[model samples]
Target: MPVTTDLVQQVLRLANEVNAFAKQCGRADLSQTLVEVAARWKETETTIVVAGAQKRGKSRLINALVGRPGLLPVDADVATNCHLTLRRGPVLSATVHRNDGDVEIDPEQIADYASTTGDPAKRRDVLGVDVTMDHPLLDGVRLLDTPGVDSLTLGHRQATVAILQRADALLFALSAQDQPVLRHELEFLAEAMERVQAVAFVLTKVEDSANAQALLEENRRRLATFVADAGRSSPGTAAALAPLLEAPWLPVSAKLAEAAAAQRSLGREDRAAKLQERSGMGPLEDYIRACAGGRELTRSATVVSACVSVLSSLTAVAEDDVASASEDGAEAARRLAEVDKALEELTRTMRDRRRHAVGNQFLGREVSAIVRARLARVRQPYEQAISELGTRAALERYLAQLPESVEQSIRAAWDDIVAEVSRLVGRALNEFLAALGLEPMEMDLAKLSMPTVWSHELQSEPGESAKLDLLREGVPAATMAVTIGMALAHLNPIGFLIGPAIAAAVMSRRREWEQVHRNQAALRRLVSEQFTQAAGEITLALEREVASWRVAVEETADIALAGQRKELEARRAELRAPAGRSAADRGQARRRAADRLARAGELTERALALRGEIGPAVNALA
Candidate 1:
């Protein structure tokens, strides 16, 4: 049976009950872990991103998917430059985020902020668009419409790639007119396969093309070969793409689907049914629903596994405490000493391990080398360009393009740092857990939600501003005009006698050269400063994350010890009770202990049963 939210809720309810029982037993630490696991289940949702090449009918496909004919704006001349995220809400609303700030826009005006040709100001700075509506299809799913991958614009490609990396699943739209996938599409898909959890292809505009099935089959075969080729170069990509190779290739006509949905709304049932059948949209919808359900099931399985691990550890600790408490004083002391010794040794070993992992591998010389190398590479091109420019116009053009180059270099360096930190932290965590005698859990750094280092606020320094002001103030309009006229006059034989004019022009050129050099130096310094600040912030965040993980490991040990000590004290008090106590009093104490053990056993059984019920589905989806 397919895993459902109801099934997950049933498991969550069981966990909550077990948590309450733990609290009643004075095991708050165990209960806290269970609470966190339950929260993970609650926040699980499937995110799907729709992407394709330019003019591939992406917006239309999205509109059809939601059964809304005019929800997203589509045009032949205008291409979407920003991401459009759709989710369920009580009323429809649109929010546009730009470099300056965010603004509330009417839903009908989304194209103004999302498309390339909507508003001139918006087209220059718009970042993304968010739309909310009361649509049933969006209840537990977030759909993102991204700019085309093969867009001529570089920013559009970068935005699409970033979104694809963060998405849970991807719906890669292909137009039937474009028979085989383009090279850029394959490259994007190869990279995306390594990041996203699932992917499926949709061949759009079937109505406009002949032999849609033949096109779909041919594309499928080519994709399979592409996956195989990618696997040869990158085994990880191959593994990630394995399951997707079997995913359904849906051929759909968004135009037909939209018309059919509209007809159904108008109560033309017969016409609607026929159009829907011809559009082949029903199977596509079913495929999306199944994938969404599968993603949820996989997420639930992860939470369940974590919960079970914690509960099992708590159970073992409790059992050990009870057994130790019933023993004589000498035996109890010996066991306590052994535990203390083991913990102390493990603590020392972990401290050294963390120093090596975080201090040396993460934030140490290796990362510093990465930053230095990137900074050098970033400065090389700009330095060369600045030095080679002989005229003011050339310098102005170089400055105009410098900011983008700096931003891209900084973002790339930050990405490398984050990836390295994540790798080191994962290794450290696994080692730390192993030292604590627990099973190692695989960690996905992408899922950790690390912050990005890129911020729009970083710009040219005050010194750089002064250099620019000097350049503008010193270079007079007449001097520039004279310089242009001198070049034109030099082409004539009579211009050779104008030595003084040539001399004045040479002097002006010398001054301009000096000003350009100063400006170049200032710009380089500004970029270096920005890089330093961003690298520092990323390092600090990573250090904090590592520190938190260490604290959690130590806290887990302390909590177990506190619980055990409390249980031991209670047992000792019972033993020290006066002989005058009635026989029924001792009998009651024994009965209470038995009841507690029985309840623990029952809870354990129930947890295992739930795992058994959901395990197969989780494995299949994963």
Candidate 2:
């Protein structure tokens, strides 16, 4: 009974392992195309997924195999934004089944999927799209048109993931182009390796290279290496996937396949069909055969192996920690503890590794670069503001001295100017004094400032050139007539008494007043002339000075930058946190876990030893 139970358990285990590993590998979908497969094994409809990047001719290859020109709408409807499902049976026209209802979206309206607005009756939006046609492969297979994992932004990754989760057989399109396995692709591969069965690789878009056959081998070699590193190597697993990591990479041309399809439909072997004839169909057929159906036998073996690995790790960890004593219950308890520790360690390691690969390497560094560039411009706005302020200051000095220069050149005919201006002032001053209606005594007419003096002071004021006349009219007119008289009295018989008297005084001292006015006028004129010359010269000097100041500021700023360089260095130092966990430490941890498992397996007399070591803990199960 124990032997029979073990046999049944082993068979079930193999199935689970094979299925899980196949799923993980196919889920990556760096290559291959998926179409709606018509075959079904009860609850799960057999959906074949072709996962690969663009330029792999996934569409063309699929079209060639199906023997149809637009079976999956490869030329126009194959957009990289969404997942496509191809189905078969009857000759169904291209219909995009929306959530509301099915719509016949003509090939011309393919853009309607991502379009903002259009005929809702004829277009499917957002929800999902189904394009089906009558084709040979439609009878037993559903092809999934997976957008190139490489070409997707966030929006498309969602769509690709949704299609892959429940895929049946995966035709992995491995382009000679997808070498070194993009970190993202590897990630998806790692996960896929745990979930599906029947994984096949199709190397596409290889028109020419240094040895297509050798390249294929090299590509397969790396695939094997990836499996080895990820702890997925199983002696019992089939060679269908094993050879991939070691074979000469196959060459495929989508264009050639497309030409074949187009020519086969057109009857006679046309010139374009010659190119298709040159393409060897052997490799293509071989890959299809490898991935066409589910591998129940292989999947069964993998499940057993995986379960054993987990169990062995649990048994070893518990037994190893014992005091080298063959205690009955002691060995079991120790193994369980070790298993728990190993699981915890493995989980932590996986989580941390994922964070570094996706969060740090994939996105964190790019984000950091953007932030760093923005900070580099932090000083720009302040520098511009300071430069503008200096320019304004220079402008102010130039305008303050403008008026005086204009008055200086006009200082020639002073005397005649004075006499005429005095008479006008004298008459006005006489009227102002009489308006007070007081008795007028002999005023100091000789000392009274003349219109000539007033005119000079008015012109002397800074920025007052336009208003010079107001001072000239207001002050002189109020004063001169009060000091100089007779001219006013004799001229007007109807003059008021005080006005006449004041006019007489101005006439009497008109000579003395004129002399006094000349001196004041001389001083005012000199002041105006000097300020005028100063204003002009200073404005010109400011232009030159501002230029010099700007240079000095720049130089000083450079010096200041040298001092601040220390702080920048400190900031950069923070970025030097170790990029990845130490591989050596991880290797040692794994070896230690393996040793413990070997001891447990020897005691239990199991054929194989499996170790599942999580971070800081080791485990084995027997």
Candidate 3:
């Protein structure tokens, strides 16, 4: 069954009941763990860290994503000097957290506290700005805008790196205008892949570059080479990092998006939508949504895992009772001892997996490597041609065909990876549950699809016909006749003036229409140019629909998206946050333990039933 919030909520309800029963029976350890798990579940968020080289439109992209232009500081002279966190809240608010304390500030004054040119004393003390606004997109997601990672400033780089360590995902921005992906970018990406779980590369300022597609191809090749070489040092980590090579590398125009936003506010819905479509923000938004969904799945799975742990504890206690009371008590005691050992080992394994998120990371790297190898095999000929030919035109043609050539391979790889990951993770998790005497659980992981490849080529179009229509439509025949008649009235000065005035008015209206049409025509060409490249992939019949292909890839591949670490660690940390449990008298504890033994079997049965439901719910989400 498809994952639903209600399913997770039901699991939580069962968990809460288990917690209450444990508390009533004075099992403080289990009850405390349950409380912490529930708290972590409630606080779960997908933290996406936006990082990039300077002047790559990272800030603008965030602004566009949230539909709040200029919300974050974006001045070239005073770029984002510190990290800035954006999340949802009841109303728009901004606060600067520092060692001293958090200081509330107006949203407009964010630059004053967060940018390089901000008040020196305030900037030095500022940790980062915590911005909360009523944006629907920010729901259950936290956006962290970091200083350019390529900054020469030690503090800027360090701050960005620190944020990267905690990020659930990374949105690494690059510019299409900036060609030949730099060594520093590859270095940062290598470091970032080690730190963050999931990453999606964005090619910003596509509108500014005529060869955005070529640039994207070049960047992908360079990044792949870097990742491949990096993988050679540590094959496991490299294999885990492989899937990221196929992660969405979208080309977008922040300039067009901001203009679209302006037009939308001015009630130019048609124009706004056209510009927005051309901006390539729609696919980017969809990718972000997919990330959020993947995170929700991770959080849900973590909660269910916690429930299973509690159930295991209860069952063990029930087994202890059986050993104490039954005739075959010695055998029961031996089995219980074995169960205890398994539980201890399983707990440690789960903790280690959660701490490092290594399982999924390794799986992701392997999946990525598979995709890269397949694509490389297909592109080998083209690579050879480029090496042999070594001509600008030949290289450009090769770049144009690069994404299209690999499109089929990517889709196939996506399907294969999804099935493989589900199979592998399911087997591992079942083995884990089996040790605690639980039934095997079905794993229905979310199947993430490859992103659509978009390429645009703009060509100039004549607007003379449009300009003529503008004049004809703006000035009616009746008005033109009256003006001419008045001008002919004995060469009347006022009549002559009126004619020129009417002509000037018509010309002005013509200019406005011309400008509008020019923009519309440009947008149309941009879109047309994109499909011209995609024609080979899409059938002629399918090409009739303009907006249809836009939705082809609804989800981004989140194979590398982090595991249960965030929630599990939060559970562990919160469980440890409070002081240790107060000690009770030995006699009192023995008596209580004996008293609870009578009802332990009944509690265990209830927990076993709950565990059955919890596994499926977790699997559905995972």
Candidate 4:
């Protein structure tokens, strides 16, 4: 049977019924698992973020997509001050969610609250805005308008980057009028790729630029070179890179699109339609719709796969119950002893395998060498910066900005390292599961917490000479390392793969020599020393990240083993319950076990049938 939204709903109902039955039968574990599944199923809203430099027409592009001109205010000098989410509703309305409270407002007043030139006092307290419209496109998708990547306020830029961590897709806008994109913009795009998988580039203001094609081509070349220079080779990076480089650069004129909408409102239908086509907003809207559709398909597939796993578990429980109903007391006791022995051996083997893999496979010589190579890449630019800057003032300016630059580079490097670690751990997990005679399960890596680097403390003191005091702390153990049992207990989305951030603090004590005797060579030496210390911290962080992966794999295996033990124990109790019952009572118990077994089989069959349909449907959508 082909799986459609209707079939997905049917399976959902089946899951609910199964959950209620489990609760009635006193299977709290299974009930809890289904409850989590239902929660995930309801969290289906797809988010697409529009991001770019300030005054790049991000707000204009959004207005064009929603077929509402002047919906979000646009100005050459002003930018969006806060985030805004546009969703669908029965009537048009807007709400400003502030730090203190939410304030409902008319849809036309969005700019008054979200734009830079809005009420200054109100804007200062604004966190984000939510707008609901009667547009068809917003049925299951939300368009998030964010502050520009080049916002002067550090908090605004940080806010944009933070939201990317949770967005499903990115619509990166590049203006043709701003021909050569800045280095910082490209860096932001690269980081965005690590977080959001589906990305599309829109060349805005094409009607205003003289040579739009040339501008687009130049950006393409620059982005390709940037990716090559970053040395990113992770599977996730590869997947993200394909659409980024291959998708047609959408050359759109939001101004023209808005004009078309205005003309149509005045009853100039044909002229408005032609202008809309020329503006290219139709194709851009299509691309956004495709991204949203693909995400929905993936979500459906994930739900179906989870259902299959739970159904398999239910089948095991029912079969075990039947076996218990037929077994004698002595046989049941013997089986319980056997299960205890198997549990002990399983734990021992899991520990041995986890230890061996972490030591020999996860962070062995090969990965260590890779980490060192990446650190060298990070050091190369600082070395060049020192040798190239001639004046002491220029050096000071570069040093002032060095902390932010170094933080970006180190974060990018860690992202690449995390990708590679995820790959190796996935393979190790597959082999480990196979050795235990378990089915192969695909796992998602958990997003690691990014620790900030305190490199701004770099300074020169009078008569201090060249002493360097460095303070480095490992990532907090509570966040990075938890007990394996704790990890096993929470078998949620982030329990399988591992990720991380390495923090380094540098404090330099240097004598403020006279401008006449400024020594470039000595500065280079100090830079090298700082890098050497940071590399040590990086290496330690790598070890911790891999250690987290080892714990994850162990937790997953333990969860599987625990499920088996629970089934066995349930079966033993069932068999022992009929110890001194009458023949009629024993017969009734067997019949009950047989009926539960039949129900489990039926649910398992339906889930498996839907699973077969899901893979092909999701692949087709992709």
In the range 219-325, model 1's lDDT, one tens digit per residue, is 87877887898789866346545555665577889989888888998999999999999898888777667656776564444444445554555565455444444
Q: Which candidate is the best by lDDT?
A: 4
Candidate 4 whole-model C-alpha lDDT, 0 to 1: 0.65
Per-model TM-score on C-alpha atoms: 0.43, 0.40, 0.43, 0.42
lDDT for residue 593 in candidate 4, whole number 0-100: 70
What global local distance difference test value does model 1 have? 0.64
Instruction: Name the lDDT value of residue 6 in candidate 3.
Output: 78
> Model 2 Cα RMSD, Å?
30.5
> What is the per-residue lDDT of model 3 for residues 74-193, given as tens digits with 9 covering 90 to 100?
763233346899999999999988878988999999888888667776677677899999888888889998887652333456678767645666888989876456666676776665
Selected candidate, larger lDDT, 1 vs 3 = 1
Which is superior by TM-score, 1 or 4?
Answer: 1
Give me the displacement of residue 224 in model 2, in angstroms. Answer: 3.0
TM value for model 2: 0.40
Q: Against the hidden true structure, what lDDT does model 2 obtain?
A: 0.42
Clash total of candidate 2: 97
The list of candidate 3 runs beyond 4 A from truth reads: 1-42, 77-81, 297-622
Ranking of predictions according to TM-score: 3, 1, 4, 2
Name the candidate, 1 or 2, with the larger lDDT value.
1
lDDT of 2 at 240: 19
lDDT of 2 by residue, 415-520 (tens): 2232333343333333332332211111111111212221233333222112324374445644555434434557775444556456445544553444334433
Error of 2 at 102 (Å): 4.6
